[model samples]
Target: MTKEQLCEYRELQKEIKRLQARIEKLKDKNEGYVADVVKGSSIEFPYTQHPILIEGFDAEKKQASISRFKELLSKRVEKSMNRSIEIAEFICNIESVKIRTIFEYRYYDLMTWQQIAYKIGVTDESYPRRIHDKFFEDSPN
Candidate 1:
């Protein structure tokens, strides 16, 4: 696997988290609509029509909007999750132990170079980076 493809895992994870947050926000807004309906806050008169009927109309529109947005966010989350799984599998399949460790620590786990060095029993943080660069340099593109 190329360095660029492996490096994309961190950003995909971030996007998944962001999309999940948006889904949660949509859920919260839907709940607020329910609460507002329960509290009769949206009640208004067409004089000839029941307040309940009017409220239902407004609530349905808001509910549809929120549902559509939540559905879109959910799809985005699924796509990111699938890409993350592919990257993780690629990282796991690398034959070199140290190189795999560097990829996992740097990309999958999102660890700093210093932390990776410590984990791999090296004194210098740059050690991991050097190994990574050298591996890619020697690898066939």
Candidate 2:
């Protein structure tokens, strides 16, 4: 795989993390809405709590919002999984063990060059990075 293509894996990982945070925020907001709904139902006049909401409309909007969020999360997770698999397959297909290890450590395991160097028994972090750079240099861009 080209360096640019392989680099996309890291970007995708970040996007998934961002999406997770957003989903968590949405869940917290949804919980607040649920609590409000429950509290309003217990009162003799529920409209006092939500003066602007029409009967049943607020609940329907909440449900639709939840369903849409779930669908978006599902599709993003699936895309991330597929991208991970593609990256794995590309790394696996490489002929050189050292090159493959570099790819796995850097992309799959999300290790720093220093950590990867230590894992491969090298003293300098530059060793692994140089190897990675050289490999990309030699390969077709």
Candidate 3:
């Protein structure tokens, strides 16, 4: 992939992970969920045309509708993930282990640069970042 394409690597990883999580939540929602239901209480009036038809909303039907909606949402997330995987894979194919680790920790692990510097045994915060930036800046177009 072109360096320009690789520029989007970090964002793609972040988006892919976010989409994956949403997909999982949607799947879980499809299973089922609890909902608050107010007790059915109908008021009777002397001059009413007919007695209040006091039947609470159908929980079964409501839950089913919610599940279907979640299923639809899951499909959308899956489609987004499909597009994201290509960029994520391209980023992962980077030859340098350190660069890969930087992306993984920064994007996937969601760690600060200070944290990454510490994990990688770099004393200077800018050292890791400089190397990362240099890799991209010096890439042959």
Candidate 4:
């Protein structure tokens, strides 16, 4: 590969690493939030009554709800990553390096398919359908 191509590859690698770190940080935060909710409830329930028992219960409930939301976000992130990996592997197998890059940038990085198509010198109207077709073609029945 040319020097410019090598530099671009390094930049893309850095971007992917940064995104992975963000995903990890979000997952860790989600776990910590869940833990806080559990700990707060455990301390407040079935034991010596604190003065602000009702307030503690309310706080615990709110925390629990927030923790649930965080859990959902974490799960969605994991699902997205898994789907991207599957798509990337399929594209790689097809020997379509450019399309694989476009797919990763659009799906994994959360850019629109239209944006990806434009970047790859295509029109927006058929971009999503094309990608969808490629994905299903590669997917197991």
Top of the candidates by lDDT: 1
Model 2 weakest lDDT span, ten residues long: 31-40
- Count of residue pairs whose backbone atoms collide, per candidate: 0, 0, 0, 0
The TM-score that candidate 4 achieves is: 0.33
Off by over 4 Å in 1: 30-57
Task: Give per-model TM-scores.
Answer: 0.75, 0.68, 0.56, 0.33
Name every residue pair that clashes in candidate 4. Answer: none
Say which prediction, candidate 2 or candidate 4, comes out ahead on lDDT.
2
Cα lDDT listed for each candidate:
0.81, 0.80, 0.66, 0.54
Indicate the worst ten consecutive residues by lDDT in candidate 4.
32-41
Ranking by lDDT: 1, 2, 3, 4
Candidate 3 per-residue lDDT, tens place, 28-141, comes to 453333445344443664543433344444668656776777677667666656656776775588799998888677655767788889999988888777876787777774
Model 2 error, position 52 (Å): 14
Q: After best superposition, candidate 3 residue 127: deviation in angstroms?
A: 1.2
Give the winner by TM-score.
1
lDDT of 2 by residue, 24-90 (tens): 7775464314322233443575546533333333677676887788789878977987887897788
Better of 1 and 4 by TM-score: 1
| Superposed model 3: Cα runs more than 4 Å off | 1-50, 58-68
lDDT of 1 by residue, 25-95 (tens): 77556342332222233345543532332232356777788888888888989998999999889878889
- Model 1 poorest ten-residue lDDT run: 32-41
